[model samples]
Target: MRVFIRIFPLLATLTASFCVQAESLSARLADPLATEAMLPLRSASALAARVGERPCASELPASPLTPLDAVDLALCNHPQTREVWASARLQAAQVGVARSGWLPSLDGRAGVTRNFTDDSQLTQRNAALSLSWLLFDSGQRSANIDNARQLLDAALATRDATVQSLFLAALQTYYRAQATQAAVQAASDAERSARESLAAAELRYQVGIATPADRLQAQTAASQARLNTQRAEGDARNALGALANALGFPAQTPLQLAALPAVAAANEFQQDVDALIAAAQVRRPDLKAAEAQLRAADASIAVARAQGRPTLSLAAGPNWQRFEGETTRTGSIGLTLNVPIFTGFENTYRVRSAEAQLEARAAQRDRLRNQVALDVWQAYQSLTTATQTVQTSRDLLASAEQSERVALGRYKAGVGTVLDLLSAQSALASARVQRIQAELDWNIYRATLAQAMGALDYSLLQAAEGRP
Candidate 1:
C-alpha cells in the first residue's frame, strides 16, 4: 500500500500526459487540407472508421469542389497551416509594436499611501496626465525597427516553407497509396495463380501422373500466396491511413485517389544546372528565410551596440499635491539624457553575443545553400533515372504480358505443364509490381524535382497535365 501510494503521483502524471496528448489533435487542426480531404475519405473503409472524418464543404453549406479542386481548399482550411500563417500575421503585428516606440508614451498614476509613523493616516494622490517621448536614442530605435522588419520577413519565409513541406508530404503519401494498390493487385494475381497450380496438381495426382509430394508443395505454395495477399491488403490499408494523414484527413475516413494522372513524356531539352541553382538561390524559402535571419542578426548587432550609447527623452507631467491648508500644482517639462556608465560589462557581452549570433547565422546560410544545391542535384538525377526506369518497366511489362499469353495458349493446347503456366503468371505479377513501383518512383522523383525548384504550386497541375 505504501509503494502504491508513492507511485500514484507518477502514474497520475503519466496518465495525465497521455490524456492531454490524445486530446490535443492540434496538429491536424493546423493542416490546410483537413476539411476538404475528408469528403471522399468519409466513404472509404480505412479512413472512415477510426477517427471521425472531417466534414465536407458541401455538407456544411454552399460548396462546389471536385477531388482535384479540393487539394487547395483543404490546404487553405487546414488548422495547422492556418496557424502558421497566423503566426506570420502575429509577427507582422509585432512590427507595429517596434514602430510604436517612435511615438509618444503617456502614463496615468494614482496612489494611496499609509503612514507608518505617529498616528495612522492615509495619503491619497492622483496624477492624471503624463508624457514621455524619445527625442533621440543614437539610432537604437531605428535599428530595432529594422530588426523587427527583418524578423517579419523571416516569419513569412518560414510560413511558406511550412506550406511547401506539407504539400510535398501529401504528394508522397498519394504516390505511396498508389504503389500499395498496385501491390495488392499483384498479390491477388499470385494467389489466383497458386490456386490454379494447386488444382492442376490435384488433377494430376488423381490421374496417378503427379506424386503426393508435388501436390503438397503446390498446396503450401497456395497457402503462402493467400497469406501474401492478406499481407498486401493490410499494407494497402496502412498506406491509406498514411495518405489520409498527409492529405489532412481524419484517421477513420476512407481515402481514394481521384484518378491516375497521366504523366507527361520526358522533355528532350535538359534544363541547365546553373539555371536551376540560380532559381533555387532566389526562391527557396529556407534560403531566403535564412538570409532574412542573417540580416536580422546584423540588425541585432547594431541594436546591441547602440544600447551602450546615450538616449535623450523629452518628458512633461503635471503633479497636484494637497496638504493641510495648502494646495500645490506643479508642471514640469524637461529633456532627460541617460547614459549607461556601468552595468557589470552587460553591454560588452551583449555586443559580443550579437556578433556571435550573426556569425552563426551567416554560417547557417552558407550550409543551407550547400544543402539545397545537393538536394537539387540529387533530385535531378533521381528524376532522370525514374524517367528511364518508367519507359523500361513499361516495355518489360508489355513483354511479360505477351509471354503470359503465349504460355496460356501453350498450356491450353496440352503442350505445356501447369508449372510452366504458373511460372509465367509469377513473372507477369512481378512485372506488374515493378511497373507500378516504377510509376510511383517517377511521381516521387518528379515531386522532389518540383520541390527543389520551389515550384510546387498546385496551379502547376494544369501545366503538368498539358505536358506531353
Candidate 2:
C-alpha cells in the first residue's frame, strides 16, 4: 500500500501529460494542413540564396559557365546523388540495428482482472518489470553484425558510383551543348560564304560572264545554307535544355556555356590498355560494391549455419500483485540454454539456401570484374579511334578550305565553271561539320574512358577546361 501510494501521483502525472499530448496530436491531425501538410513554396530569390550558400554551387563570374562549374552544380542539385546519399544513411542505421543484438532489453507490463462468482466479486492488479539478455548465440550475432557492416560498405560504394555516373552524364551533355553552339557558328559562316558566292555570280551574269543557270544555283545554295543555320540553332537550344536537365534544373532554364578549346596533342592520352584495365579494377566503385555484397552474402551463410546451434541467455523479472485484498511481491533470475532439436529440417534448408546465394553472389562478382575490364578495353579503343579521327578531320577541313578559295578565285577570274565552285563550297561545308563532330567525339570518348576507369570527377572537368 505504501509503494502504491508513492507511485500513484507519478502515474497520474504521466497519464495527464500523455492525454494532453494525444489531444494536441489529434487536433493537429484534424487540421494537418495548418500544421504540416501545407508547406510554403520558396521564392526564386530564396532558392537562389540557398543555392548560393552551398559549397558545391558554382560561383559564376558572369552568365557563361565553365565545365567545372556545370559539374559542381549538378553534384549539388541532382536528385540522383541525394537519393543515393539517403540510401547510404539508411543502411548505416540498419547496421546499428544489427549491432543492438549484443545489448540487453527491458520491458514493463501492467494488467487488471475482475471476476464475479456466487454473488462475490474479486479484483486483481499486477505490475511487472522484465529484462532479457542473450549471453551467446553461437556466432549468429557476430555474423549478423558483419553482414550489416558489409552492406553499409556496399551502400557507400554504390553512392560513390552514382555520383560518378552523374558527373559523366553532365560532362557528355556539356560537351554536346558546346559542340552544337559551335555548329551554329559554323552554319552562319557557311551562309555568309554562300551569299558572297551568290553576289559574285550575280555580277558575273550582269556583265554576261556567267549564265542564268549559275545565278539560280548560287541562290539555291544560299537558301540551303540559311536553312542549315536555322536547324543548327534549334539543335543548340535542345542540347542546352538537355544540359539543364542533367544539372537537375528546369528544362527551360537559360544556360550560357563557355566555348570548348581545341584538342590537345595526341600524346596526352597515350597509355597501355593493360594498365588501364588494372586501374579500373582498383578504382571502379561498382566493382567494389559487388565485392562487398559478396562478403555480406558469405556472412549471411554463417548466420544460417549458426541457427542450428545452441543459444545461452539470461532473464530476470520483478513483480507486484494484489488479488482479493491479498498482496504478494515476487522476483526471479534465470539462465536459459536453447538448443534447436527439430524444426522439420527448416534450419538445414536455410543453410543450403544461404550457401546457394553465396555462390550466386560470388558468380556475380566475377562477372562484374570481367565486365569492368571489357568496358575499359572498349573505351580505350574508342578513344584511340577518336583521336585519330580528330587529326584526319582537321586535315580534311584545311584541304577543303584551300580548295574552296582556289575555286572562288578561278571563278572570279572567269576560268572555272559554276558547278566546280558549287562542289567546292559543298565540300567545305561538310568538312566544317565533320571537324566539329570529330572534336566533340574525341572529347566525349576521353571522358567515357575516364568514367570506365572510375576517374571521372571535378579534377577531370578542370583538366578539360584547361585544354588547348
Candidate 3:
C-alpha cells in the first residue's frame, strides 16, 4: 500500500498517456495535410471538409464549371489526391514513432491467485508498476528522429508535386472538352454549307446550266459533311466523359462546362530556357522531395553505426502483495549498461547497405535534376510553338472565311463553277478545325509549362487574368 501510494501519480500519468496515443477516426476528423505552397490543395481540402469548419458538397455545382472550379473538384474529389495526402499523414505518424524512442516505457500489472495447501486455502493479491528508460544510445535515437523528419519533409513535397500534376490534368481535360465542342459547331456549319451548295447545284442542273456530274458531286460532299458532323459529335461526347471522370464524376455523368477563356498573348513565359530551368530547380517539389530523400538516407548511415555502440538504461518499479493475512510493500530501482560484444558482422553489413542506399539516392536525385531541365525545355518550346500557331491559325481562318463567302456569292450569281465553291467551303471547314485545335493546344501547353516548373497555382490564372 505504501509503495503504490508513492508512485501512484506517475502511474496514473503513464497510464493516461499510453492508453491512447492516436486519435480515433470516428471520434474526430483527420488533420489537415495541405501546405501553403499547395494553394489548390488547401482550397480543395477546405471544400472537401478535410480541414474546414463545415462539410462541403461532393457533388458538382449546378453552374458550369470554370477551369478553377474543375481543378478544385479534381483536387478534392479524386482518389489519387486523397491517397497522397493520407500517405503524407502516415509519414507524419512515423515521425511520431521515431520520437517515441526518446521516451520511457511503463507497465502495470494486477493479479489475484488462490493457492490450496494440504489443510487450508490461501488467497494472494499482487499489484505492480514498472518503468524503464534509456539514458544513452550513442545518438541512435537522434539519427532515427532525423531520418523520420526528413522522410516527412519528402512526403509533404511529394504531396505538392502530385497536386500540381492533377491540376494540370484537370486544365488539359477542360480545354480538350471545349475544343471538341467547338469542332462540333464547325462541322455543323460545314454541313449547312454543303446542303446549300447541293441546292444550288440541283437548281443549276434543272436550268440546264450545271452538269449531272456536278449535282452528283454536290450530293457526295453533303453526305461526307453529315458523316463528319456525326463523328465530331461522338468525339465531343468522349471529351466530356473524360472531363467528368477527371472531376471525380461517373464517365456518363452529364456535365455543363463553361466556355474556354479567350486566348491572350503569353509573352510572360518567354524567358530564357536556362533561367527557367534554374528557377524550376528551386521551386519544383519533386526535386525538393528527392533532396529530402537523400538527406534521410544520410541519416540512416548514422543510425546503422549507432546501432553497434553501447547503451545505458535505468529501470524502476513498485510492488504490493497480500498473502496469508499479511501485507507487504516494496520498491526498487537500478541502472544498467549494455555493450554489444559481437553481432556476427551484422552491423558492418547494415552500415554498408545504408551507404549504398545513400549512393543510390544521390544518383536518382541527379537523374531527376537532369529530367527536370528537359521537361522545362520541352514544355517551353511546345508553348512557344503553340502560341505562334494560334496566331497563324486565326489569320488562316479569317482568310478562308472570306474566300468561302466570295465563292458562295459568285456561285449564286451564276458566275462561279461548282468545283470552286466546293473547294472554298472545304478550305474554310479545315481552317476552322485547325484554329480550334490551335487554341486548345495553346491553353493546354500554358498549364503544361506551369506544371513543368512546379508552380501550377492560381497565380498562373492571375497572370493571364482571364485564362487557365
Candidate 4:
C-alpha cells in the first residue's frame, strides 16, 4: 500500500509536468497570424468560412482599390510572406530546444518477473526513476542557446525583408496597370481624332474639294488608330493580370485599380546619397539578418572551443523492488567529470571548421553591406532620372496638345493638309503614352528606393498615393 501511494504521486506529478510542457510547446508552435496569412492563399471559401464573412474580393468596396490596398492583400495572401513566418516560428522552436538542454531529464521504468524452480515459485516487481543533468559544460550550453537566439533573430529579419520586397512588387504592378489604363484612354482619344479627320475628308471629297489620295490617307489613319486602340486595350488587360498575380491572386482575377497619382516633386527625395546609404545600412532587414547570422557563427565558435574542455554532470537513481512478500528500496546520487583528452583530432577539426564558418559569415556580412549601399545608390539615381522624365514628358504633352488643337482647327478651315493633322494627332498620342510611362516610372522608382532602404510598407503606399 505504501509503495502504491508513493508511485501514484510520482506518476501523477510526472504526467502533470508532461502535460504542461506539451501545452507550452503547442502554444509556441501555434501561430494565428501565419495561419490567417495562409488562409487567403489556400482558398477564398476557406477564409470566408473561418471569418464568417464573404471572400476578400467580394467584400472589397466598389470603388477602385489603391496601391495600399493591393499591398495589404499581397501581404495577407502571399505564400512567400507566409513561408518566412513559418521559418521564423521553426527557428523559435529551435531556440526552445536549445534551452531545454539546461533542464534535467527523467526516465521511468517498471517491470514484473516470475520464476519457477523445482520446488519454488517466485514473483518480482520493480520500478525505478533515473535523472541526469549537466551541471557544467564549460560555456557550451550558453553558447548553443545564444546561437539559437541569434538564428531566430535572423529568421525574423528575413521575414520582414520578404514582406518589404513583396509590397514593392505589388506596388509596382499596380502602377503599371494604371499606366496601361491611361494608355487605353489616350489611344481612344487618338481614334476619335482619326475618325473626325476621316469624316472631314469624306465630306470634302463629296464636295469635290479633296483628292482621292487625301480620302485614302485619312481612311488608313483611321484604321491604324482603331488598331492602336485595340492594342492598348489588350495591353491594359494584360497589365491587370500581372497586377493580380503580384497581389497573390490568380492572374485572371479582376481588379479595379485607382488612377495613378501625379508625380511628386523632385524635392521629396532630395536627401544626399551618403545619407540615404547610411539609412539603408541601418534599416535594411536583409543586412540585419546577415549580421545576426554572423553573431550566430561567432557563438558557434565558442561552442566548438568549449567542446574541447571538460564537463561536469549529476545523476540520480531511485529504485524499488518487491519479491516474495519482501520489499527493498535503493537510491543513489553521483557527480561525474569528463575531460576530452583526444578523439582522433575530432575536437581540433570541429574548432577549425567553426572558425572557417565564422570567417565565411563575416565575409558574407561585408558583402551584404556593400550590396545594400549599391542598391540604395541605384534606386536613388533611378528616382532622380524618373523625376526629370516626368517633368519633360509633361512639357511635351502640353506642346503636343496645343499642336493637335491648332492642326485640327486649320484642317477645318481648309488651311492644313490631312498629313499635318494626322501627324499632330499621332504626336499627341505618343506624348500621352510617354507622360503615363514617365509618371509610373517615377512612382515605381520611389517605391524601389523605399524598399532598398527597408522602409517599404503600407504607410509608404498611403503617403505616395496621397500625394498630388
Candidate 5:
C-alpha cells in the first residue's frame, strides 16, 4: 500500500504526459491543416508548393509533327545547334574584321606626365590623333574574306548534315520501339498458349492418356514462355527509353508516337539507280561543302601570292595636337604608298600550303562522290528488300493464322495432341513478330533512302501518297 501510494504521483504525471502527447498526435492526424501548420517552415512550404502546383505542360511549344519533322524541330531548338550558329555568326564577324583592314583606322591619345629634376618639378601634357591605313598587303585580306565565306557555307552544310542524321536516328528509334511492342504482345500470346497447353496436358495425364513426361514438358514450356514474356517486356521498355531519349525527352517521360506515315509503294522504286545517284550528287550538302572548301583554298592561294606584292592606297586625315595651358595645333594628312620587301619566306610557304590543301580537297571531293553513290545504292537495296519482306510476312501471317485456327479446332475435337497445338501457336507468334520486323525495316529503309537522296526536307506523307 505504501509503495503503491509512493508511485501514484509519478504514475499520474506520466499519464498526464501521455494524455497530452496522444491528444496532440490525434489532432495532427485528424486535421491536415493543423498537421501542415506544425511542420517545419521550409518543409511545409515545399509540400504545399508541390501539392498546389500544376504540371508545367504549358512550357512546351505547340507544333505539328511527323517523326521526321519533330526531329528537325528538335535539332533547330537544341542548344548545340544554336551554339554552332553562333560560331558561324562569329566567323562572319571575323570576315568583317579582315575587310576593315582595307580602310584607314584612326586613334586618339591624351596623357599627362610629371618629372622631378634636381631642384624643380616639371609637368607636361599632350594629345595627338593619327590614322593608318593598309596601302597594300598583297591579297591577304581578299583571300581571308573569301575563306570566311566558304567557311560559312561549310557551317551551313554541316548543320544540314546533323539535322538529317538526327532525323534518321529518331525515325529508327521510333520504329524500333514499335517493333519491340509487337514482340511483347507476341510473347504474351505465347505465354497464354503455353499455360493452356499445360492445363490440357495435366488433364490428359490424370486420365492416363498422356505420359507424365508430357505433363512435365508442358510445365517447363510454360515457365519458359513466362521468361520470354519478361524478357520481351524488358526489351520493350528499353526501346521506349531509347526512343524518348533520341526525341530529346526526359528518360522518365512517357512517349506516345502517332501512327506511322504510309509507306512508299514498290512501284515508285522503278526509277533507275544511276538517276538517283546523279540526283544525290547534285543536292547533297556535304558535297557542296567540300566544293566550297576547295574554292576557298583556291582563293587562299591567290591571297598568299599577293602577299608578296606591294600595295598602294590613297589616304587623307586631319590630326590634332593639344598642349596643356596652350592653344591646340592641327596638321593635314597625305597619301601613302607601301611596298612589301620580304616576309622571311612566310608568304611563299603559305602559298604552297594553300595549293596543297586545294589538291587534297579535290581528292576528298572525289571520294565523297564515290561514297555517296555507294550509300544510295545500299539504301535502294535495303528499301527493296524491306518492301518484299513486308509482303512476304503479310502472306505468312495470314497462313499462320489459318493454321493456328485449324489446330485449335482439332484440339477441341480431341483429335490433336498438345504438341500439335503448341507448334501451331509458336508458328503464329513467330509470324506476328516477323511481320512487325518487316514493317519496321521498311520504315527505316525508306527514311534512309530519303536521306541519301537529300530529300529529308521533303514531306514523307506526300511522298507516300497514292501508293499501295
Candidate 6:
C-alpha cells in the first residue's frame, strides 16, 4: 500500500503524458497532409495538390489550355510526387524517434497467483512499475537526430527533382502538340496551293496553251498534297492524345491546346558554360539530395560508434504485493552505467560496415556531382543551338513563301511551267515544317535547360505564356 501510495503521483503524471502523446498521434494520423504542406509547392504552386494522399478532383476547363495550364495539371497529378512527399514525412517521424532517446520511459505490470500448499491455501497479488531515463549515450542520440534530419533533407530534394522532371515532360508534350497542329495548318495550305495550280494547269490545257503532261503532273501533285494533309491531321490528333496522356488524362480525352504565341518570347539563355554549371551545383535538387545522403551516412557512422560506448541511465522501480492477507511493499531508485562488454565482434563489424557505407555514399555523391555538371553543359549547348535554329528557320520560311508566291503568279500568267510551280510549293512546305520543328525544339530546350539547372518552377511556365 505504501509503495502504491508513494508511486501514485508518478503514475498519474506518466499516464497523463501517455494520454497526451496518444492524442497527438491520433490527430497526426487522422488525416493526410494537405497539398500545401509540400516543400516543393512553395515555389511551384501550380504543382500543388494532395496527389497521393487524396483523389485529384481536378476538372478540365472547357477552354483551351495554355502551356502553363498543361504543366500545372501534369505536376499536380503525378503519383511520384506524393511518393516522395510520404518518404519525407517518414524521415521526419524518424527524427522524432531519435530525439525520443533522450526522454524517460515508464511501464507498469500486474499479476495474480494462486498456490496449492499442504499448510495453507494462498493467493498473491503483485503490481510493479518501472521508470528509466537515459542520461548519456556518448552523443548517440544527437548523431541519430542528425542522421534523420539529413535523410529528410534528401527526401525533400528528391521530391523537388521529381517535380522538375515532370514539369519538363509536360512542357515537351505541350510543345510537340503545338508543332503538330502547326504542321497540319502548313499542310492544308500546301494542299490549297496544289489545288489552285491544278486548276490553272487545266485552264491552260483547255485553252491550248499547255500540254496534257503538264495537267497530269499538276493533278498528281494535288493528289500528293491532299495525302500529306490527311497525314498531318492524323499526326496532330496523335500528338494531342499524347499531350493529354502526359497531363494525366486518358488518350481518348479531348483536349484543345491554345494557339502558341505569334512570336515565342525570345529568352536570353546565353551564359558561360562554367557559370551555368556552378549554378547547377547550387540549385540542382538531386545533387543536394545526394549530398544530404552522404551527410546522413557520415552521421550513421557516429551512431554506430556511439552504440559501442558505455551509457549512463537513471532507473526506478516501485512495487506492492498482498500474500496470505499480509501486505508487502518495496521501492528502489539508482543510476546505472551500461558498458557493452562483448557482442561477438558485432560492434566492431558494425562500425566497419558503417564506414564502408559512408565510402559508398561518398562515391555516389561524387558521381552525381559530375553528372550534374555534364547535364547543365549539355542543356546549355542544346538550347544555344536551338536558339540559332529558330532564327535560321524563320528566315528560310520567309524566302520560301516569297519564292512560292512568285512561282504561282508566273504560272497563273502562263509563263511558268507546272513543274516550277510544284517545285516551289514543295520547297515552301519543307521550309514550313522546318520552322515549326525549330520553334518546338526551342521551347523544349528552354524548359530542359531550366530543369538541368534545378531552377524549373511555375515561373518558367508563366514566362513561357508571357504571364507576369
Which numbered prediction scores highest in lDDT against the true structure?
3
Candidate-wise lDDT, in order: 0.73, 0.84, 0.86, 0.83, 0.72, 0.85
For all predicted structures, in order, the TM-scores are: 0.78, 0.86, 0.88, 0.87, 0.79, 0.88
Model 1: what TM-score?
Answer: 0.78
| Residue pair clashes in candidate 5 | 138-306
> Model 3: what TM-score?
0.88
lDDT per residue for candidate 1 within 164-200, as digits (tens), equals: 7766766677678778887998899878877877787
Candidate 1: segments with Cα more than 4 A from true spot: 1-83, 112-128, 194-221, 324-327, 341-344, 464-468
Q: Kindly list the per-residue Cα lDDT of model 5 for residues 1-468, writing each as its tens digit.
A: 999999999999999999999998998665523222322222112211222332112122343334543454345444555565555556555566666666777888777788888998766776676777776666778888787678767766665666566667766877787778878888998898778778878887888887887788789888988999999999989987876565567666666555565454475764899999999998887888888878888887887788777776655445444345565666666666677677888978988998999999999999999999999999999998898998899899999989988886776557887778778878988898898888889878888998898776435633553221
lDDT of 6 by residue, 227-256 (tens): 999999999999999988887789889988
Q: CA shift at 232, candidate 3, in angstroms?
A: 0.8
Number of backbone-clashing residue pairs for each candidate, in the order shown: 22, 0, 0, 0, 1, 0
Instruction: Quote the lDDT for 195 in model 2.
Output: 92
Q: Which of candidates 1 and 5 reaches a greater TM-score? A: 5
Residue 181, model 4, lDDT: 90
Which portions of model 6 miss their true places by more than 4 Å?
1-57, 117-121, 264-267
Candidate 2's error at 341, in angstroms? 1.2
The segments of candidate 3 whose C-alpha lies over 4 angstroms from its true place after superposition are 1-43, 46-57, 462-468
RMSD in angstroms, all models? Answer: 13.9, 9.2, 7.9, 7.9, 18.9, 8.1
Q: Order the numbered candidates by lDDT, best leading.
A: 3, 6, 2, 4, 1, 5
